[model samples]
Every structure is written in structure tokens, then in C-alpha cells.
Target: MDITLKSTLPGHQNPVFCVEKGYYADTFFTAGNDKGVVEWDIEHNAFKRILCAVSSSVYALRLIIGTPILAIALREGKLLFVDVEEQKLIASLQLGIKAIFALAHMSWKNELLAVGEAGTLHVIDLSTYQSIYEKRISTTTIRAIAIDEGLGRIALGDKDGQVYLLDSTDFHVITDLKLHNMPTTSLAFIHNKLLSGGRDAQLVISNPNQLHDNFSFVPHLFTVYGIYPHPEAPIFATVSRDKSLKFWSSDDFALLKNISREKMQDGHHLSVNAGAWSQNGQYFFSVSDDKLVKIWEIKKIDKLVANS
Candidate 1:
């Protein structure tokens, strides 16, 4: 990948598990073992402020676009809705499960879907901020979720190493694929294709239309905790417990760059828990067990060519 470490934002008191887009294009949010979700200004790599404080660790965060509301999933299965603009906890709901692992916002359906240790998916009606539906999709935990709006499909990966494609609106299972030998820890929709990462340290990218026909490779030495696809670039990144962040070609899933502890003196020493690209794809952010968020500035291809 034609990228380099731009700067590191340090303030999270504990391991940061998730990073997400902020209200603006130049801003973003991150949370994890820490007690509050944090907002950062990317322009100066500055920590803006704590968006909201929580009682337990945060596992995932999603900002409802065009609104000040921030959705937080906690380790204890409590989901909090906070209005960042007003800076107050507006609503809190318990999904009645433990360790809510992921949350997918369906803008088209105006719902929030959360999955966790219970293997039951909780559907929250964003309009009411209440649980409207719940269903157990696996005997094991559903650790990852990715909604492909263009395809009208939602991809879910479970602790059983199985990835299921579901009808986004009706929540009916369309197809299931066994992509890993261990728990499928992360999932992403790179355009129309589905990419998955696993505890087996494997990365599999496949055409969702024909799930069985796929490409697989071992991308890390430990569990792949995150898979972040660029909103506009032809590349994606995966962070791992192996304490490394890697960039891959979206076209062929080729290893483009491997930023590891062995190669970079400034890389995360602990497991890189999660990563996200900015809404404009100008920068990439990664959070880790080391209690830090590192930002990578992307240099444009045209700029690189001119410099070359």
C-alpha cells in the first residue's frame, strides 16, 4: 500500500477495539476497553473530546449519519444511544445478551442490528430506540457483521467459522458458507464481494453470488480482528492479534504492504483490534491493545506519480 504512518492519537486508557467515522469528514471516533467513546480531529491528529462515558468496555460504535446520535455496543450487552451534539445519554437499551460484538446500521430500513455472545441478533427500531425483533441465528457467538446496501444483503460471521448471507429487510438466510476452520472474527463488503477474516488467521474473499467459489490465504499469524475497506480506493486492510496491519489489493487480494512490529519501529506492540477508513478515504485509522489509535495518511496516486 502507498501509505505511511501519519500520526498516533494517544489518550484511550485501555485497548481500543473500534474506530468509526465522526460527524464530519475530517473527524472520527474510537472506543474499546476505555470507559468512553472518543472523538478525534484528523486535521491535526488531535483528540477532540470524549463523546460519551460508559459503565463498561465498548466493543463497537456507529454514528447515525446526518444525526448527532452515536450507537455504542458494550461488552455487557448494553447498547447506548448518545447525542453527541447535546452531549447527553439520550437512550440506553439492553439487548438481554452478553458481549454485543457488532452493530450494523441499515439506513434503508432505519434499523440497528446487534449480535453477540448469545448468537441472537437483536433488531432495534431506530425510530423508537427499542428492540423490535430478536432471533438466534447460531449456537455460537456472531462476532462480525457487514451490510451490503447495494446488494440488499447482510453478511454475518459466527464463532462457528460460518458466514451467512441474509436478506437485509426480512432477515432470512439466503446462503451460508464455511470459510474458516475457526471463528470468523471480521467481515467486510468490498464492493459486491464479501471478505472475511478469522481466528484461524485466514483471509477469504468471495463473490457472494457464488459463495463456495472463493480465494483464501493466511494473512496474519493470529486472529484477524478487523477488515477495513476503503470507500473509494482499490485496497483494503486487515489488522491482527499478531500486532500488524496489512494492506491488500482489492482486485486480486494481493499483499501490497505489511506494516508489522518487525518492519516498523512505531507499529502497535499489542494486537491491533480494529481499523477504519475515513468517509472521504483520505486517512486510515487503527486501534490496538496498546491503548493507542494510529492514523495513516494516504498519498494520492497522482501525487505519487508526479513525485516519482
Candidate 2:
């Protein structure tokens, strides 16, 4: 597959911690050490508005589908519910845990899930905006969480190099496997398999039903911060502290492309923290410690295909 740089946007003054794909067309939100949550109008290439600015670093942001509400997780264990359209804070809560590094909207249960430094996971009801449940998955810091809404499964990765698979409905542990020897930084479900990456600099694929069915690769030179699957295609993207983002086929774990200024001139100069893929699979947005958000698209495929 061929890719091209479409746009490089500068907004956040500090490292952008996260970029989330909003429900609205051509809209997404970004936040980080800048302590500000800014929404962007991707189609128009302009800033839409600030959701909220906090005293602490905003580590994660998740948009509630079919609603204007956004859940913001902070570095100091605080959670904020913001009305995105009105650009105002709706409610706030102190999680009393630690820095929250991951957030997921569990629509099926009308709850928001957050995990972080304390090794605790908090489930907040969207309707009541209250913590209904909290559980400790490990003694180590939890760095990533992924939910498979259709299958009712939740995956959690921690600093101890463990991956916990649980049933979202009851939060029952299905399997707790040591997939990495170091901190597990990213988790996702792609093509019916659980994909995990870590500071071990390894990406591992495993089937939930069969422990024997697994695949692993040392794809990067440093910590892997994020891994995002394509909306429709059999591919995914991973960002690392090695200062690069790579595309891979989910089916066979094959590397398709490496994206970086070292490989291509238009890539990020620092470590890429996270990335979000558009709903249509036409474009990708990546944020980095360089304080830049880049938009990438598949460079005209027809001509390349014809020539081949």
C-alpha cells in the first residue's frame, strides 16, 4: 500500500497525548501536556473549539457516540465530562486512583472505563456520571485498555507485562496471560485476535479461545505507545518511541509500510504517542511528542496498481 502526507497541523504546545475520532463528520479532538482539549475541524483544516482546559495534563479523551458528551481523563486521576457542542464542562469527578492513561466508552452498558497508574479500573455510568464499579486488575500500572463491544470483552495491559482478558458484562476474568516481559503499552482486537504491544518492543497476536495460537514480532527499536486497526481493511498502524509509525497486515502480521521522515521526509521528528483512523479508512491522524498532528492518506493507488 502507498501513503502520502496530506497535512501537518500545529496546535497543542506540549506533546499531544491522544487524538480521538469523534462521531461527527470531519471532527476529532486532541489533548495532552498542554492541559487543553481542543477540537478540530479536519475537513476545513481549522480549530473548532476548546472543550476544557485543566490544571493537570489531559491524558485520554473518548467521545460518546450519538451524543455531545466527551470523557476526559487526566494525569492526576480526575475525570471530566464535557458537553462538546457547548464547549463546557458538564461534570467532574476525582477518581482517587492515579494518572489515567486509557479510556473506553462501553456503550452497551452505558459506562466509561478508565485505567491507569494505580493499577485500578473505574467504571462510571454515563447517565448518572457516578462511579458504579472499580476493580484492581494488577499490582502494576495499567497502561492500556481495549473493549470489543460486539463480543462483550475487555482487555487490559499493565506495567508488569501482563494482559488480562475479561467479560465486560460482569468484569469476570477470562484469561490473564503474560504476553510481554515488559510494560504492555497498547491493546486492540483485530480480526478476532487480541493484539498487544509493549516497551519490550514486541507486538504479539493471540487467539482468546486458543492459547496455543499465537504470533509475535519485534517490530520497533523502542517502546510501542499505540496500535490502531483500520476501520474496514485487514491492516493496522503502530506508533513507537523509536520515532516511527508502521502499517501492518492484521491477518499475517506482515509489515506493509514504515512512516517516518527517516523513511520519508514528511514524518514526525519525535516519538509518536498515538494515532486515530477515520471511520471511512481514507485517512489517518497521528500525534507525537513533537507537538504536531499529521494527516496521511493513501497516495493515488490506481496509478501505482496499473504500473505494477
Best by lDDT: 1
TM-score of every prediction relative to native = 0.94, 0.94
Per-residue lDDT tens digits of candidate 2, residues 1-308? 78988788887888998998866768888889986888887787778877678879988888887798988899989999988777778999999847999999888788999999999889999999999999988998999999888778899999989999889878978888899999999999887888899999998888854334778889899999998988767778999998899998776788999998789989999999999987567778899999998888866544433443
Q: Model 2: clashing residue pairs?
A: none
In model 1, the Cα lDDT at residue 31 comes to 92
Q: Clashes in candidate 2: how many?
A: 0
lDDT of 1 by residue, 1-308 (tens): 46788898889877888999887778899998877889999988899988878889899998887788989999988999998878899889988748999999999888999999999888999999999998889999999999988898888999989999988878888888889999999999986788999999998888876577688889999999999887766788899999999988777777888988899887999999999888777788999999989998787844533433
Tell me how candidate 2 scores on lDDT.
0.86
Error of 2 at 3 (Å): 1.6
